[model samples]
Target chain A: MAMSRAVLEGRAEDTDGRLLLLDPSDNVLVVRARIPAGETIRVGGGVPVPVPADLPLGHKIARRPIAAGEKIVKYGAPIGTATVAIDLGAHVHVHNVKSDYTPTYHLLGGEAGR
Target chain B: MTMRGWLRSDGRKGIRNTVVVGYLVECAHHVAREIALPFREEGVHVIGFPGCYPNAYAERMMERLCTHPNVGAVLLVSLGCESFDKRALERAVRATGRPVETIVIQGTGGTRKSIAAGRAFVAAQRAALDAAPTVPMDVSELVIGTVCGGSDGTSGISGNPAAGRAFDMLVEAGAACIFEETGELIGCEHIMAARAATPELGRELEASVAKAARYYATLGYGSFAAGNAEGGLSTIEEKSMGAYAKSGASPISGLIKPGDLPPRGGLYLLDVVPDGEVRWGFPNINDNAEIAELIACGSHAVLFVTGRGSVVGSAISPVVKICANPETYRRMEDDMDVDAGRIIEGRATLDEVGAEIRDLVIGLAAGGRTRSEELAHQEFVLTYKSFEPIGPACLPAA
Candidate 1:
C-alpha cells in the first residue's frame, strides 16, 4: 500500500517521463504506465508539471483556474462550489472550499437538524 | 471452512430463525407493531410499507420477502382502505407452506381491537413456528446483500471493496449475492453497462443509472454526501468511482425495482430510485430504507459499509458492518466487523482483506452470528413511495 495523505507521505519522483490528464473535470488521471519523477509529460497540450515522483492510482491533480464561484467538475458533474480562487495545478479541497450548509457556533459542534 | 444452517423449501438458508409481522400498508403499521411489541423477545419483526397506491413492483417484493427462507411465518395486517392486494400477499405466504394469517383494521373494529386480535395471531404463529424442524444446510444456500450509508472517501477503498470481495466469494460458493442503491452508481454507467450479462441487460443497467442521475439532479443532491467532502472526496464523480466498485466483477444478471427478487442470481442491481416523478424527493430518505429494499429483494443479510460510520442494524435481516477508515474505526470500534482501512495503513493488502472478508461471508452464511445480530439489533423502518415495473431487458434470459 502507498502512503495515504499526499501532503504528509507523498514524495515527487525524479525518474522517467510520461504525462496523462484525465477529463476536463477530473483533477488527476492514472499513470497508465509508470513514469519517473521530474520527467515532464505535456497534458492538454499545455506545459507539463514535473512528474511529481508521487502519483497514486486515483489521486487528484488540478486542471483549470478554479474561481471562488466556479464548480469543481469531476466525472463532469457539479459536486460543489469553490470558496476561494485556486490557481492552476493547485490542490482544491476543504482548506480552500466549504459546504453549502452554514455553520452555527453552538459553543461546541451542533448536530445537524438539532 | 464452512458452518451449518437451516434450509428452507424455497432453496434459501436462514442464519436466524424469525417471523416477520408484515403490514401491507400504513393503516396496519401500528397494529402490526403492537402485535409484535408483546413478542419482542421471540424475534418477531414488524416490517411494512405505508403505500396506499397499488404498485406491482412493491407487491411482488413483499411476496418474495415474506416467503424468504429466513422467515418462519408471516402475519399480514391491512387497513382495508388501502389498495395493496392483501389476498395475494397472504396466498403467496401460504403457498410457501409458511403459516400465515390476515387481520384487517377496519374489519376487526378499531386500533386497540385490531392490535388485540393481531397479538393473539402472532402468539399462535410463534407456537406453530417452534414446531418447524431444523433442517441442516450450508453456506452455499445463503444470500447476502450490501449497501453503504454515511459514506466518506475511505468507504470506496475500504469497506465497499472488501464487501465486494465477500460478495464474490459467496456467489462462487453458489450463494446468491446482491448490492443495491442504483442512485449511487451514476457516473459509472458506461463501465457498469459493459459488465451486464447481455447487451440488452447492459442497456437496462445504463437506464437504471441514468434514472438515478436524473432523479438526484432534480433534487440538486448527487449521492456525493457532504461527509464525503470532509473525508477528502472532491467531486461526486470521484465519490461515484469508489461507490461503483462495490458490485464486484460479476456480469450483472438483472435489474429489479424495489420489492422485485432476482429470478436466479449472478449479480443484480436493486434500483431504489422512484420510477415516475420525484414524489418522495429522494427514493430512499435514509439508510434503513435502502436496507429494507434489500430485504424486499429476498436478501437474508446485508453488508453495511461506512466511512463516517453508521451503526444501524435492520429489523429482520442482519447487517455485517465493515469500517473503511482506520481513524473512524478506532473511534467506533464496537460497531464494525472487518476494517478495510488496514490496507491503506499498511497493516493489510486488498487481496488479504478481500480473502478475510470472503472468509467472514462464509462464516456468517454458515450461521456464525454477526455483531449486529448478537446485539439483538433489529432496526426496522418503512415509508411510502411508488415505483414502476421494470422494462423487458430488466430480467435475465429465460
Candidate 2:
C-alpha cells in the first residue's frame, strides 16, 4: 500500500472539506480541507457525506457519538474534551472541543483562533 | 498526465536547475558570496554551509547535494584553517562531471583576492552551464520534499492539504516525494507505520518516532510549540498529522536519512531527528536547516506550507510557499505560491488548488521563477551533528 490512503473521498469540496481519517482505528478524522456547506463529503465509507457548514482542515470530525465533557479522541489520542455532546460526523474544533489540560491564549481584540 | 525530466550524470533526474557554492568554513562565507554574487545575472544560484567543525555527515551531505541532479556546477571556498575536507568535496563533485572549482582564501591572499579568484571560477561555471542543453523533462524525474514552518491552525486546514493534493499529482507522475521530522509524527506513528511497504519498514518507522519522542521529552519540549497552543493545535501528534499530509497519497517505497538518495521513485521519510542519544542541541535549529537537509536528500525543489507566514527560502533548491489562512494569505500573497486560503473561503476546491500547485512545480522546473527565487531569498546554514547509518530495515523490501 501507500504511506497513507486517499480518503474514499478527497480535495475538499467547498470552503471546508473533509479532514483526514488516517486510520480506521482513529476516533476523530483530521480535516483535509475546509468543509463548505452544500457539498458532498465522505463521512467515512459507503457514500459522499454532506456537511452543515464549513469545517476547516486539521479540525476533527466525530466518527461516533461523544458526550459533553467526554474526551475527543483523534488519531487515538485525546485532542481535547467536547464542550458539548457530539453526534456522528459532528465537526470537532476549538469551538466544540476545548483542551482540558493546556490553557489557550488569546490576544486582546485579536481573538485566539483560526 | 506523465512528465519528462532532465537526467544528470549521477543517474538522478532533477525537477529544477540549480547552481550551488560551498563554504568550507564560517570564515570563507564572505569570499564564497563575493564569488557567486557577480554571476547573479545568469541564474547562478549560491548555497553553502558555514562551519569550522569537521563533521563526516556534514561533508557527505555537501558532496551528495553538490552532485544532485538539480545542480549543474559547484564552487568550494576554503579559508585554509578549518577542518572541512575541501579536497574530497571537490573530488566528489568533479567525479559527477559537473564543473567544480575550489579557491583557498589564505593562499590567494585575502577576501579581496579570493573574491576575484572566486568570481573567475563562478564565471567559468556559469559559462559551462549556459552551454549545457535543455532537455524536455518528465514528472517521474522530479524529486520533491515538503515541510511546514510557522504553522497555525489554518496551516493544517488549507495549506498542508493543498500540498497533499499537489503531492498526489506529482507522485502519480512518478516523482519521489519526501516528508520528515519523526518527532512530530509521535502520535501518528501507527498510521505512518501501517503505510510502510513492509513490516520491517513499519518497525523502523515506529522506532524513529519513538526515538524522537524520547529526545524531545528530554529537551522539555514537545514538537508542538507554545505558538501552536496559541493557534489552536492541542498536541504534537496533531501537528504531525498536518505535516504528514504533505507526503500526499503515494505509496511509500523506502526510508532514507538526511543525505541518502532514494533507491527508486515514490515517497520516503527523512528522519531528521538524529539516531542514538541526541548529541546535537537540536537536530535543526530552525526551518532553513530542515530545508537544507531536504536539498541534501536530492530534493530538486521544496513546498513550504505556512499558516503564520514564514518568508525564508533555501540556497540550493527553489521553495514554493503555500499559505493556509485566508487572513495570512491576504497579508502575504506576494510571498506565497499558492493562495490555498481561498480553499477555506469557499472559492477554490482542494483539487483545484492542488492542481495549481502541481502546475506551478512543473512551471518552476521548466524555468519559471518562484517568488522565493525572484526575491533572491538565498538562505543557508549548517552545524555540527553525528548520525549512525540506518540499518537494512530502513528500505522498501527490508
Candidate 3:
C-alpha cells in the first residue's frame, strides 16, 4: 500500500532508471525497459552500472554480485539459485540461474526439443 | 450495483443465458460444430470432450458445465459409439430443470440428419432463452475465478497483483473468488498455507502443491513453459511466485479441486492437479483448459492475466483480459480489457487498476461484453483427468 517516492513524483524512470527493485532484500531487479549491451544505466540511488548483455524488458538484472550456488532473491524470496557466479548488472536468467524446484525449459538450449 | 441475472432452478444466478451445444466425443465434433454454426452470433456456444473412452473426471466436468448457471439450455451431440455416457449426461442436465435434448449420429440416421435435428433443438431453445426472464442480482451472489498465463516479471509486479487486489475486493464484498493452478504455485505453498482459515486447510493446501510438484516431476516437465522462459522467467518457483500473486492477500478460505464449487463467499485455492497419478499427460494442456475448469467451478466470469499475451475466452464464461507488460498492451490493445502495465509505468497505482477490474466485472454482469466476447473468442478445451472428493477440512462452515 505504500507508494514509492519516485512513483508519487511521476518520475520512476529518473529515480530507479530502467531497473526496478521489487524488494530491498532482492539481489535482482526487473528491467522496466530494454537496455542494449554497452549502455550504462543507473541502479538504486542512481549508481551507474554497465549493461553486459542486451537485457530485454521484464528480464532480471543482478542488483549485486551473486556467488555460485547462492540463492537468487526476488520479491524478497528465493526464486532460484545462481548456477554460476553472477556479477552486478549482468543479465540473470535461465543460463546463469537454475530452479531448485523444477528444470526451466527453454527452446534454444534446454532439455526440451534438443 | 444490482444487475439483471438469469436465475437457474438451483437458485444460482448467471450474467449470461447462453445455449451450450456440446459434442460428447471427438467423433461428433464436426456435426456439433455445424449445428451451432448458424446460431453462433445468437449466444450459442460449442463445447465438447474429445476422448472416445469414458473418464469419470470428464463426465463430471461435462455435467457441471452443462448445468452451469450461465447455460440456459443444452443440446447434446453424440457419435453413438463413444464410451461417453450421453444418457447420464442428459439426465444430469434434465435434473437441473433446464431444457435438454440429444441427437445421436447413428440413431438420428446420419451426419446431415443429426445436424438438422441438433439445429432444430438449438433453434427452439435459443428462442426460449431469448425470452427468459432475468431477476435482480447482487455482487454477493457472484462467483469469480482468476488465472494467469504467459506470465513474466511484470505479471508479479503489475497484472497479477492488480488482479489479486480485485480478488481481495471481491472477497470483501462477500463474493466467492477462486484462484487456481497449484502446479504453478510450487514455491509459494508455505506462504499460501499460512493464509488458510484453518490449520487443517493449510495442510491440505501444502499437500496440493506438493502433489503438483510430484506430478510435474514424474512427467519431467514443470508448469513452466517455453514462452514463460522467453518472457524472462527463469524458473518454476519464480513463475509460481508471480502466479501466486493472483490470489491476493485475502485469508485462504478453502481448497477445492476442478469441478468443486466454493461453499461460500470468500477466497478459495483450486487444486487443479489430478489425484493418485500423472495419468493425464499434463494437468492442463493450455490456458483454455484451465478456464474451462474454472467455469465448471461455477465462475460467472474469469479474470485472465497475461504478460506475453493470450487471446482466449471461455465458452461458458466471459474472460476479462488484464495485460501486464506495457509493451505487450501496446501491441495487443484491442485484445485487452485493462492495461495493468500502467502500474509498472507509474501511470496508475495497483489500487486504481484493481478498481477498474472490479468495475469491469460489475459492468459485464449488466450485459456489457468483454473484448474477447466482441472478438468471438468462445474458446473451450477439456481433457481426461481424475480427482478424489474434498475432505471436511477443505471447506469448514463459517
Best by TM-score: 3
In terms of docking quality, model 3 is: medium
Better of 1 and 2 by TM-score: 2
Model 1 has an lDDT value of: 0.69
Judged by lDDT, which candidate is best?
Answer: 3
What is the overall TM-score of model 1 with all chains considered together?
Answer: 0.78
Q: Order the candidates by DockQ, highest first — what do you get? A: 3, 2, 1
Query: By DockQ, is 2 or 3 better?
Result: 3
In model 1, the Cα lDDT at residue B231 comes to 55
lDDT tens digits, residue span B280-380, model 1: 76678788888888887777778888888888888777788888877778898888888887754647766677778777766765657677776667776
* lDDT, residue B247, model 2: 68
TM-score computed on alpha carbons, candidate 2: 0.81
DockQ for each numbered candidate:
0.11, 0.14, 0.51
What's candidate 3's DockQ score?
A: 0.51
Off by over 4 Å in 3: A1-15, A45-47, A109-114
State TM-scores per candidate: 0.78, 0.81, 0.96
How accurate locally is residue B101 in candidate 1, as Cα lDDT from 0 to 100? 88
Per residue, candidate 3 scores C-alpha lDDT tens digits across B331-362 of: 99999999999987778988899999999998
Better structure of 1 and 3 per DockQ? 3
